[model samples]
Target: MKVVAADSSSAILNEKFDPLTIVATAAVLVDSPYREARGSLPEPIYADANKGYEVIVHEAELCLNLLEKTKADVVHLDISLGAISLEELSPIQFTNMKISTLGKQHLLKILPRIRKIAGEITRKYGIEVLAIGKESIPVRIAELTSGANAILYACEKTLKENQPVLLGLPSKCQPRISDESAYLYSLMAAEHDVRGFAADQSGVLEKVHISEVLNPIARGFRALRIEPKT
Candidate 1:
């Protein structure tokens, strides 16, 4: 069982992050030092007013295209597109939720096309998409009204369906906890869904950067890390 703890003086973002310059990306560093655990606190803690980590939301192909054209060393992704299809912003899910939604997101209808597009794009450019998200437990990556099956099944349809390349990703833990390492962790997690990425240090979350109401986990790669322009 994991717990969300709050601490100001020793939060990782405060201690490790460069407060003066904006935190653009993080690298995985390892030492014998382990993160110190703080006392368990209640949920929805809003002591800090920071907007949490800034995230960029765009289609998967758009992201990949950016990566290739720039030839940048690293790219970060957060799956949270923000209630993509939902009408009510107050109760948005899956980043792109739309109006009058009731059941699971239409994964079956969209997944195939989305995967096909990604496959075609990947094939043409060999662009690598970095997958990031919380360690979800039966959590739908996004909301679905009907296309859920195809969205998931699209995995098999793609050429990289079961390739060794598919079993790679940076890390498996929540994004903010390992703020500095999220980028590296994400790279490994992209390779392996269950790789269980390791971090150099353990630290607490400051309410300043993390909002009380945001679903950091449900946000996916869109909500996980920064978009570095290289």
Candidate 2:
């Protein structure tokens, strides 16, 4: 099945390829300290940087809405427990929090709730929901801040040989080789087609099988030199 791994960092999806299905995935990071003015999740909603789960039910509804808009065939949601918003912390602080005993306790406390939310979304939407936890993730990607990369990687690997996987920013990204690119390129030698690029090459484009491309900054686009299955 053709699948588009959308970068949901924004409210709108901007993928160039058309797929039979779209994948929306994220982790629930409980935001604990918004007042510190230092390291923390964006705001009240620690898990969803853009939208927090005011109530588990509300979060599920929001998921439904997003699915409707994206016309997604399935949703893969990863719940990252005890993961702090380390955006502004020092290296020491980040390391400390990641390994802190208390932090893990906090993560354990909220895991059940996160699972409930995932269940609600699955039941309400009648779509496949792959609820991923931290343990299931690849050690390399799990060492990072979120499970987005792992989710994308799993999606890419699940495809049969010759299946196409569209990779794009799920959220607003830095220049090139951002975390998103790291995960996308991770699937380069896999059994799927990696379709996405920025204005500037991330420097690893040549490592993968990419016979087709669309301009990164162009408004309108048309696929160029699409590679056919062997």
Candidate 3:
């Protein structure tokens, strides 16, 4: 008994390898990378200055979604909820509220299916569908999401700047992580409690305000934000 106890003690003292931490690898599908580019690097939809892969989705192009080329834990839709003006946009100055209204309605009709596809994809791949867009897109997504945070993304700058004048949205961000990956993962986690995003590289991110993203959209766009259901 004494000899065995001594041997056990020596083994414990001679342990070499360090402890291992639990790690999770996640993949996200982004349809469009055109909207938010900061310098040469594509600014992730959500990322933390202090950590890794909070949100990393490649540009999820809508044209290829039908082909099943991408699978994501969470998808950042590329479809803009606002409309493209047929009323001679070149002549119309300032914001086109009327045209935007038409766009939102179209977005509304399209989203239920988007929700369905999001749900279907999440079920098939065991992931979550995140309904994100400039300003109004999230609102429409939230309407379908039923008091869920499924509707979230960086807001447009005009709304952020004119928040006091024209606060179009009803609810706040609902205490969700604003970082793109965190936002994406949270929605995914809401569905299946997944673990991580794929952007694990060092120095893969930069910082900017959410309001900054919204600014360009309000100015004008031929932009689109897709719903999985659509």
Which candidate leads in lDDT? 2
Q: Tens-digit lDDT track for model 2 on 1-230? A: 11111122211113544322222332222112211111101111122332322223333334445554444444333333233321222334434543467545444454455456556555665554443323322211211212233233323332333444443323222112342343232222331322222221232223233333443654333222212233
Worst 10 residues of 1 by lDDT: 138-147
Candidate 2 TM-score to native: 0.29
- lDDT for 144 (candidate 2): 26
Residue 172's lDDT within candidate 2 is 24
* Runs off by more than 4 Å, candidate 2: 1-63, 79-106, 133-230
- lDDT score, candidate 2, position 111: 48
Estimate, for each residue in 15-107, the C-alpha lDDT of model 1 and write its tens digit. Answer: 222222111211111111212211111111112224322212223433344334333222223323331211111223334443234222433
TM-score of each: 0.23, 0.29, 0.24
Mind sharing the TM-score for model 1? 0.23
- lDDT string for model 3 (1-230, tens) is 00000000000000121111101111222223211111111221222222221111222222124215433334434333233321212222324444365555544444445545555555555544433333322222222221111122222322333321111111222222233432221222232321112221321112322221122323321111212221
Q: TM-score order of candidates, best first? A: 2, 3, 1
lDDT preference between candidates 1 and 2, better one: 2
lDDT (CA) for every model shown? 0.24, 0.31, 0.25
